[model samples]
Target chain A: MAAISVELFAYPWDILEATPERFLDHCVALGVTRAHVTVSYHSGKFLLPRNRSVRVYFPEPGALYFQPDAAAWAGGLAQPVSRLAGSGWLERLARGAAERSIELSAWAVFFHNSALGAAYPDLAVQNAFGDVYPFALCPSHEAVRDHAAALCRSVAALGIFSGVDLETIGYLGYFHGHHHEVTAIPLGMAEKFLLSLCFCPACRAACGSAGVDAESLAAAVRGLLDRRMQSDDASGGQDEEAEHVATLLVACPALAALIRLRMETVTALVKRLSVEAGSAKLAAFTSSFVGSPSNIWMEGVSPTDVGELVECFHLLAYAPDVAQVNSELVFFLALTSDPARVNLTLNLGLPLTTSFSQAAAKVEYALRQGVRRFSFFNYGFLGEARLRWIGDLARIARGDSR
Target chain B: MTELRAGVIGHGYTGKLHASAWLANPHAALTAVADSDASRLAGLPAGVRGYSAYEQLLADDLDAVSICLPTHLHAEATLEALARGKHVLLEKPIADNLRDARRMLMAAKAKGLTFYVGMTHRFYPELREAKAQIDAGAIGEIVAANDCVLEHLGFLNVPQWYLEKKFAGGGAALTSGVHLVDRLRWFLGDDVRAVAGRAGNSYFGADVEDSGQMFLYFRSGLSAQITFAFMREEHPLVCDLQVIGTRGSLTVHTWQSYELWNNSGRQRKVFYTQEPHPAKVQAGIAGEVEEFRASIVEGRTPWPSAEESTRAVQAILAYYESAATGRLIEIGDLHAV
Candidate 1:
């Protein structure tokens, strides 16, 4: 495992708005030694924009990408918006960071590109009914794979980025943060999972080559989802999502092979990106929203084989309860190569409804789970008090003060 | 923002209640309060400024306003607050009439202010979990619903206008029934196709109804039968919702949740929050207000937007129309033009 100290997630806008010196000063004051800044990001309509030049809705493709000399890539731009003409943004940060001694980590968002997906809709993920979700780029597509490798190289070229935090580099799922999204069709989580299963040409061909009957499975899935939507039965127990998967797998034994194939695709993509990184360490950013037990399989981004290639697993443990946080760490660690390489991120505000003591306890439990390093979510999003709580946890993590 | 400055309007029962909530909320402070009756406004905790009129309260800087006024004044207070570019957490039954509700929504939108409709159910942990799971499509597609909230009105301590139709709107249905009505539309869908009801004042004799039986048809092929009454026994508050879906069924109450399916055995999940009534009420207000504060600071939309709350008001209005004409009222008739 690569050695890492206390880190705080940040944004370039945060640096530009607060000015690099002031932002670095704030980091120093908070006792943070590193900043994982987003280079490529998505377009968002924030609540109070222009007033405060900080925070974003969600992480999207953030950094510029290089067309690797080895791959034949025709995709215009992998990311939707360009920071444009370098903005001398990375250079300025590197200069500012050099003075403050704050190590910079490029937070790279690989997929979930509205811009690229919209342009090459065929490269985007296709649902069971053949509905193309342009927001999610299919990992099977050569362009996406090529773009990912290029992205890693581009961030490493920034000179200031000492490490890389990889986000959404694998399969994009049904879950998205598109505001005001109307779920007109009440699709169950399992049904949505079925829909997220890419029946696109690439996925189908791969499944066929692997001896899995992709065509019949897709039909069966479509029929199952349609029937469930029409059934409206209320007696389903707590394990309905599990039940749905079990029932489907029983009907088509080949479905398990399809899932295994997905894991291989994502693993290969990461390995290629890891090779492209040269010396920069890769940290897999994994969060299943709220303690989803089967998130790795559901998203098809298992961190087992890539442990040697990747630096650390940046696990998101946002739940308030210490037990829940422990459970999340246990689940991630059981699958991860080295438990010590896991860097757990805890929520300090907004989504967290627990007290500061409870939040501190979550950090304590995560540390007990053999997680060596720790990082809070983006410094700009949380309230000042939560930021203070981060300082308190820093103290608590070291067992220096209560 | 570290903390939010909030004020409560109308020193009615809930007004005093939510003011204390704001004070107790870690993210909020009860900076100012307004009540028409000075006597009602008396005995407030220290440091909270007082006002006789809501307009005076609006003059002061406020991030959000919790309108605890009567049903009649809900629209005016909310409008006054929104017009001043303040976020609002108006209590249920956003307005007495749909017109005022629309006006308030438009004003809030024009200013880009968040309007959070305060529902007590939002505070219940188990209820919120059920709502989230339902939103995630756990129980296939909804086909039928059964919901009821029965309580004795005499035990409900409030101002005198509650007995008057003009001030409180209708009695049992508007006050207590709106909670379940909002929950149904929220958990089900806002596209309530039809509504029919029969209500009476025989129990309380307050000129407003004490018992209400309302039936609602949803566009998602789900029909809900809701019953609300003012029970005097005080045995306990009976509030539960049972939703039937194609693949499964779920019965959710404040304290318990149960899921049942065709071939599977029923599973019951019970959570006990056995605090006293006053403590529960205080917690509910504080939880909602804290959430409202967080929404403002975090730049996120509040749960169940004002537009969604309007559907609750719309359903109640349909129920009234049905009771008046002794016929089913199509929900489309209540749609704002």
Candidate 2:
């Protein structure tokens, strides 16, 4: 098998709290050559079980971990920077990574910012019911798209990054995590798709420009969704996801056309961001929350389309065993033109992986299938044992079992 | 209402227990029942109308219904009955999810019907006595607790629907585990601030978990460990609760017995049941039925109100969420989805 390149996903708090030298040295020893460090991200209650201090870390909502040039925000959304970032933590970490020859890539999350959405409610994704999902920014808006591009340009302008990992560049759905959220209603794939469909003014105008009747589509979604909500319909199973989407598309061709427009919108935005990333390799991740590589169109992401635009397409193989990982890989790889461009990103710890053998088997299988790149998710969440597992995995990937 | 007319839906195991409870309650009349299977409806008592479809039974005049349907059917059947202005005594874990449970509660409230979630385990003699002792300061300054239930009542022998998450919400965690969780919430108060759990289908190879474990942290500086396993018959069946307090401690085995002890470990009190397990369980169900009937007649909220039951459901759902994400989930973050 060919040797593989390994990347470790990390956050600024993980490195700053644990000290960058120790964190980066640990990554280098584990055979990680690149660190996809979080630069700009959304809010979440993250558990840092392996951190030297701080068991739980709540990130500043939609804050940039690095200083942004004022010129980048001239005509875009406000840039919220973390207190630590303003205090030069990002610069310190960048220096540490450069000293170790570890390529530091900027991982920026766009459009999934509750802070920006809250600041500009009109730019947030408005569902069919006219309810604003302040957690997700509507990508169809010119300002939101400009802000994302600006984010890329600013991170690239920092001149310390090798690549930019663009996440959530498309639309975030209704099921996006909100604080104390209670969506206990079992929603099927079709129902979720309808609920996720953005009807914001910009989205409506985009559809309208494409000769699709936006109002009628919104009415249809509202009616179908209302019936499902008011009635006692049991949710459809995962196996029925394709069937559900197919049936909905067959019944509502306008929705199908509208979805096509959404995919186009996301693809166009990614292309623009790639251009904005001056000489830095632009990478796009598969849909994390809303959909997978197979049905990412629901999140307005056509995997093959976006896969063509970026240097790497990172697919989250967050499954328990080799079979599930294989299935996710098979489905994702089938959709792309070049399988080598796909990087398999797996979680190093539980709920996704438990043992080195289980994780290694997935890596070996991916290697045998011509995938020579892997990314281990989250340096902060894993403990010593799982960290060692990643080290073993790196050796296995390099054809040196010892 | 001098006498409440009662109907029992779903003639399964819980359905039969509910039917017997309605018949045994003096203030309630067992008037009708519905079951999907004709064989289950064969032995309906004289003058008690039987229908294969619950809808037909709902059309009949009834003041209340003992909705012993499967977890998935709970929302639909209860909502229909509530729409007809009938009181609902829904079986535990209220519904498959919180949204349906909330809807059922709202429908009952809008119609001014008594909505009770039947948690028979709470009415178990030993458990009831344990609660009474704790309330009476027999166990002072409660500090910690553990609740565990292990039995062979899982995928192999139960209804097929119980194995599917779409039908059952979850396996052992939401099914039998919810009872222990509910009892803990009742004993310690609804102060579960966060939960961390582990669940899986280690046995039976079913889609849902056959065994589950949860660590709950209460806001009152108390913590609890809750475990449930729907294991093989060879595994000794145990339904146990042990609570530790500053002054004393107590242990209770549902339907069997309980023991209390002082700080020095001297046995202060002990109570054991001579009755068989099945009979004691039936008696507990009967007690809940009587409570439901009294609540309707006296226009009072039942012992375990809809909100309380929703809390149990929320806790179980949070446990499931924690298990899936492998993270500590705050109970406050739980909402209907």
DockQ of each: 0.01, 0.01
Pairs of colliding residues, candidate 2: A182-B335, A182-B336, A183-B336, A183-B337, A184-B336, A184-B337, A185-B337
- Cα lDDT of candidate 1 equals 0.71
Q: Candidate 2, after superposition: displacement of residue B256 in Å?
A: 48
For model 2, the stretches where C-alpha displacement exceeds 4 angstroms are A1-3, A235-240, B1-337
Q: Candidate 2 chain A, which ten residues in sequence have the lowest lDDT sum?
A: A233-242
lDDT (Cα, tens digit) per residue for candidate 1, span A1-402: 334367788665545444444566667767678888876655564321221212233333333422222332233254544433233345555665777788888887777677777878898888778988787788887777877777777666555677888877766766554657775455655666776788889889889889989998889878877887677665432333656766666677877788888888888888887777767888887755313533656666776765556888777777666786777678778777476778877656665636887877777776666666888876656555566676677777766655
Question: By TM-score, who's the top model here?
Answer: 2
Q: Fnat per model, in the order given?
A: 0.00, 0.00
Q: In terms of lDDT, which candidate is strongest?
A: 2
User: By TM-score, how accurate is candidate 2?
Assistant: 0.54
**Where in model 1 is the C-alpha error above 4 Å?**
A1-4, A47-78, A81-86, A184-186, A234-240, A289-294, B1-337
Whole-model lDDT, model 2: 0.81
